[model samples]
Target: MRLEKKVIIVTGSCTGIGKAIAKRCVAEGGRVVIHGLEPELGQEVVQELGPANAVLHIEDLATEGVAERLVAVAVKAFGRLDAVVNNAALVLSSNLHTTDLTFFRRMLDVNTLAPFALIKAALPQLKQNRGCVLNIGSVNGWSGEPDLMAYSVSKGALMTLTRNLGDTLHREDGVRVNQINPGWVITENEARRKHEQGLAEDWYKDVPPVFAPSGRILWPAEIAAAAVYWLADESGPISGQIVDLEQYPFIGRNPPKN
Candidate 1:
């Protein structure tokens, strides 16, 4: 029960890694407020966690006032906020030429700006409770794939945001912030995206070892485990870290074999 009695807000929690984090948080004795764009999916997670442990908030981060509203809902439901996981993001594919101004803005708004708004909205409460923040960044934050230009830029901004706030807030208000940049993860959304992109249903199972060094890509639960450690008191006041959760070192890689 690392998070016993803690109250947390997890955006994009209707599915995928966010869903796993919400479930894990509750299982460890914390209450959660789940957020997503899909009402049906959000309700499902709320029901899964039960009324006693979870609530739902349907939000589009592109909309104004939603960030403040999300924080309010969490505090209203649980009486206090102990942590927030900024896990919602737009993971669309776009190369340099394909990334128009509108597309780039949308990516930044969802992946980077939304987290900034959320942390700002939750700051006062976090200060009061000495709470923490967890940003779900991506390995793309580094150099990134050529196909993921705008998305990569957004994540890079988010990484910088994590470091900037982590340093400032912890020094001033005792609020800790950290980020996790996970490699390829197999989620329901990812599988569906693969199917939509003409891949077979078992595409995940057949991933090449070069991409999945452990013979498989990561699962949502694995990321959740590390998230819990950062959110819990056991992490002991450390802040401003961007942890890359990958099996292989991403730097100076050789091109794939023919």
Candidate 2:
């Protein structure tokens, strides 16, 4: 396995992309610390990932001291930290004109600030290990989304943060910082639940082809593979790059399934 003996932390492991990342890391022989808001569910994931490779830490990353605390736990339990995937985010579908200051602030606080703080907290350890960081960014980060204005701003800030940190650390600390901008993935559980809730049968039909002419929603496992590639035995000059999860147009390809 490529990530044998590596130690990584993935936030928001309760659901969606975070859960997929955690599972993939463990399967690749990495030691992963899965963070989620719910402890029981997190533990279930940890157990499924097997005894030695996975552990769960439940906490809200947006809390004042949570970043530092999570870092401490990783160091204390795993002995070293090799990578961090900042996957936690908050989204609100609201018009910017009517959205309150509090609502906007909350979006920034959880989506942008928490990731920034956590990366900083994990920086020294990553430096010590000469490790890599993969931020879970968004397509909306580069292109503005009218409905998700606050969320878009937060993700945009995160993309800029990734570039800034990647620039500084690649030269000085040997810590590679990159981001993944995933398009859309429909999980089986979510799809089934939404179907039960009377959701449209072909709602995703309207979403952009996501850089690829092929009209298919990107899978959670697709994003997981990208994370593994970054975390694994990768060589070559890699820094400050945004690995677009959406396929490039006319290539007729899927992302590297490491």
Candidate 3:
């Protein structure tokens, strides 16, 4: 087990990529603190991973002081914290014309500020364990699409936060921080979102190559696999890095031809 005895907190873990990460962590012999907005899903995940290896905490991270509560749960359950995967995020799409301060603040509060609070709350335990933090960022952080103005801006800030804290904590506290910017992951939430947007249930099947290069979108488990490497001791003190998980070059890409 690559992560034998390690204790990790995976926020937004009740579903999507976060869910996959919690499962992967336990499968690799780690204990985990599962968190999300859905209590039932959180409980189900804890049950699936077994109570001994996992515990659930349902939190709206945007709430002030909740980050500390999450850390406390981890410590209370397993007595230590080895890593934290800041994977919980709110992804709302809005173009410049539709974007407003309310939406912008909501996006930043959940996507950016919450992660910062969690890291700060867990810093002491992390320092003691020589632990690490893995941030689930998005390729959209690179200026995002016109339809995702606020979301893109939030992710860009998150990327900056990851780099800033990764460097600061590594130097001052021995806690490694890293990020993964994933592109077009297929998940229950993503599917629901598409359906809400009037796409067919199998809309992904007909997506253009520009959207899904492999004739399919990325899977949550793939991100989970990469996350383990960064969270585990095997990464060996590396920090301040971002991994872009996508099929194409993020820069200077030629538009797809018909």
Best by lDDT: 1
lDDT, model 1: 0.93
Determine which window of 10 residues in candidate 2 has minimal summed lDDT.
Answer: 249-258
Q: Cα-based RMSD of the predictions, in order?
A: 1.1, 5.1, 0.9
- By summed lDDT, which 10 consecutive residues of candidate 3 come out lowest? 204-213
- Residues 1-258, candidate 2: write the lDDT tens digits: 888889998998877789999889888888888898888878889788876777778887778899998888788778999999999887556676868999998888998899889888998999898898889988777765677788888888999988998899889998888898876567644465556767786655554544335666777888898888877757445888886676563233465443
Report the alpha-carbon TM-score of model 3 versus the true structure. Answer: 0.98
What is the per-residue lDDT of model 3 for residues 48-145, given as tens digits with 9 covering 90 to 100? 99999999988799997899999999999999998999999898889988988898999999999999999999999999999999999999999888
Sort all candidates by TM-score, best to worst: 3, 1, 2
Clashing residue pairs for model 2: none
Better structure of 1 and 3 per lDDT: 1
Ranking by lDDT: 1, 3, 2
| Count of backbone clashes, every candidate in sequence | 0, 0, 0
Per-prediction TM-score to the true structure, in the order listed = 0.97, 0.87, 0.98
Stretches off by above 4 angstroms in model 1 are: 254-258
